[model samples]
Target: MEVKNKVIWITGASSGIGKSLALLAGQKGARLILSGRNTARLIEVQNALPNPECAHILPMDLGDIESLQECVRQALGFFDGIDILVNNAGISQRSLIADTHMEVYERLIQVNYLGTVALSKALLPHFTEAQSGHFVVVTSLMGKFGSPWRSGYCGAKHALHGFFDVLRMEHQKDNIAVTLVCPGFVNTDVARNALTGDGSAQTRQDQATARGMDPGRFAQKMLRAIEKRKMEVYIGGKEVSGVYMKRFFPRLLHKLVLRSKVV
Candidate 1:
């Protein structure tokens, strides 16, 4: 809903889409709790906000699911409780399944899927007690359609859709909302930091990702979707068409994905 005066907790707030969201939310007068593993970068983002005083930094590692509840407690203590929790912290994969190590998959799942789940569960009690809260998930277009070199990434994102859909259904009575924001290819370092077969960062940007929508613009669209409490929203360029293709013409989408130079 309206962001003004609302307490919003955003993960991955150091850079990329999360940073963009923090900036935009700050402009909208929302009190923010910014979370990420990079303390310096988080502080940098906070300082860049229009109202840095209204923002709190909470450095956290989403991969560490066991510590998430404690993180949640700290976040709640920041401003009594968070009115919205944005699940935006995640890692990506850039290798074929056959070539990827099991640890790579585990890493992706731990950060992208289980991490989101753990944090959401930790915050669920608060949301239920208040009976008013929003969970905004930043997933991917690949969550809906399979891709060339993002098997583990796709799996993790797809799992988010499943879990959040059920969460929305089960929590409807509590007036808690779930919004899944599926971004196709955003212009960010996600590809550069993507995990490879050996679990090392890809350290290279993808052509398509480099040419994707600007994170600032994407965040604006994302906030609009959250305001409307949409169940799912897709943000990107032509790659967004892939989601619809998968819905009505899976075979065509499959063929197109096979022919496209994803990385």
Candidate 2:
């Protein structure tokens, strides 16, 4: 559907892909409710929008699952209604399973999977009543295939696919759409912000991630997929081929990932 005049709520809007999506969607004339943990950064994004008046800042921590229902309530109040909810707030992993702490896994699951599910569930009745809404999930290619140094990240992302796929099946009658946008790798602070062995931020960029697709370019592709209401779309460079390789040539994909400099 055309995004012009649509009310779009985007999570993790402070920077990276979410920030790009918010800016582009605003430029397209979509009203926005930008949510993130950083209030200052969220305000910065708001001011950067083409029509700042059309955008609202709602700072939230996705990892705090209990607050999401209230957060959704506040978000809906911003625009009276929401046409799309983009689940883009998530963390990445950059540690081996053997060294990673269980707390790290829990944090990843809380923010990346359960938090998204809870927020979506809280907004379900609204979408049901409207009989029209879209759920844009920014999952990762890791959700589809495994890679070294990202076991927890992979697990959490994979769970999102399972949950959202079922959600689509159950909510189709409500005229609700689900679009799972799987990004292979994008030039973002994801690596730098990734959780390491003890649940601390890695604070360093990965070589592969440094050369990934631009966040703006990736956002453009993602918005197109959302407009088309695609069930799923993978965005990235050559790493995108890994999805097919994992499906048609699992052994080869496994070998390739093992050989690659994942970090």
Candidate 3:
């Protein structure tokens, strides 16, 4: 809860929300382990922090499932123990299921869903043994609703909700906390990097995403949720309303989604 002096491991720490969180966490006096595929960029982020020495960059590809256990081992060893694990490394889909190849869906599942699961499972034993650890998962609003042009992304995020929800229930007695963070459209490179029909990046930002919440503001709200140890928190602008709409008025939300030009 108290970020100061806490050992937090943040995946996808090179840029965007993860980078923001890392800087904020560093300012708050948290010892950080920043991980991402871009080693140089991760080091850049570490250097930008308030106390560069307080953060360590651990480059890793979450999609590489075989190496995740070893990654977790290295993560734990960095600070002797990890107080929080932020599952933020993920890719997004920007094409319709009909246009998308099977490989696209598989890649999304492998990187976004399975990678998160593998890392969490690898760290579960340590958390159970400590009986005091937090798993903060950065899912998406798409995880709560199926929208156009994001079938694979939505499915993978939805799967994360199910997994973390169950993890919360199973680990409650163990004193392990699970927090699912569902972020709506945020101003980030996510859209530009979103997977297309052929599993290639979209290379262009969507209008809505470009106008979405600022990554720094989103990160601030995210840290608040983590501090409160909330079961789940949705952070965004008007798009966040969609979560409530889907909850109490699914039919209405469905109609709106069908008519709205999300892209």
Candidate 2 — which residues are off by over 4 angstroms? none
lDDT of each: 0.94, 0.95, 0.94
Give TM-scores for every candidate, taking all chains together and pairing residue i with residue i: 0.99, 0.99, 0.99
- Of candidate 1, the 10-residue stretch with the lowest lDDT total is 140-149
For residues 110-200, write the lDDT of model 2, one tens digit per residue.
9999999999999999999999999999999999999999999999999999999999999999999999999987999999999999999
Question: What is the Cα-based TM-score of model 3?
Answer: 0.99
Q: Best by lDDT, which number?
A: 2
Number of backbone collisions per candidate, in order?
0, 0, 0
lDDT of 2 at 186: 92
- Reference-based lDDT, residue 44, model 2: 96
Model 1 residue 111 lDDT score: 96
Model 3 lDDT, residue 136, Cα: 98
